[model samples]
Target: MTTTVAEELRRRELERYILEMEWEEQIRTRQAEKHFKLVEDVFRQHLGEAERMTIRQLITGAAANGRCEAMVYSFPARCCTDGGRAIEKNLPHWQKTLQGNAKELYHVFTETAKPQRYGLRAAVVDFAEGFPAEIGFFVTWEPLFFRSDESIY
Candidate 1:
């Protein structure tokens, strides 16, 4: 049987396409493995120590930048009860949607930062497919100026 040049080209093209797909799948598998490994490491770490280190870093970075507020932490929106809708909308009860480390961080903020006049704010920081993808917790401090009722001469 005689093979035409067009047939040879088609065969080569199909083989190339298959190789490219295999390469892409390998890359994706490697990325997934790395992600899972990192997640495992996070889960094995000390929670309180991690929280304290994060808080320290946030404070130090904010002071160095001469800023009163900084994003202290972020997490995937899937961890939230409403997938971060409450945070995106700035609702009062957004904290109730927090889960896992995000919730623990909020409690730490209330117990430690709040009493020290630091305000905590949660907001949706990223979106995917028109939905919240990640939520960020910001620690803020701004002095309150009280207006006096007395008239000035």
Candidate 2:
């Protein structure tokens, strides 16, 4: 089947949480610890107990459950896709746009009273042996935040 720009993206990846930092900071680095802490902090410090039920309801909503908003928020790298390539190369502008309207998204994944449990990561994989190539990122379903865990990466 011919894949659309969106479908081609599927070949790329998906996920929520995983340690994504420099190799030197891999298994036994402070960065790994930081990643773990970020995840924990989301569950502990963020998950608003008072609004929990409401947020859960929103997540359960038909639209929220399957909406594409998460994609726009989590993978700013979507620019790498055919449709988004231009945007990716023009990152400064993209960041500017993100800094503007995407602040809410940033909050969900980066900061706020409680941010979404997600961050960017890169992996250096050899597409062809002896070739140095890196691919990074994982989209995750942060345990019951305001939204249901129906996330795609």
- How close is every model to the real structure, measured as TM-score? 0.59, 0.26
Poorest lDDT segment (10 consecutive residues) of candidate 1:
144-153
The global Cα lDDT (0 to 1) of model 1 is: 0.68
User: What digit string (tens of lDDT, one per residue) describes model 1 on residues 1-153?
Assistant: 999999999999999999866655554444334333322343233356666556555654554444556786889999999999999998989989999988976776676557656688888899999999988887776622224453211
Q: Give per-residue CA lDDT, model 2, range 29-148, as digits (tens).
A: 332333344444443454555534433333233123333112212333332333233343445433333333233334554553234434432222223343323222223333322233
Error of 2 at 10 (Å): 50
Name the weakest run of 10 consecutive residues (lDDT summed) in model 2: 67-76
lDDT, each prediction: 0.68, 0.35
**Top model by lDDT, which number?**
1
In the predicted model 1, the residue pairs found to clash are none
Error of 1 at 34 (Å): 37
Best by TM-score: 1
Angstrom error of the Cα, residue 128, model 2: value is 20
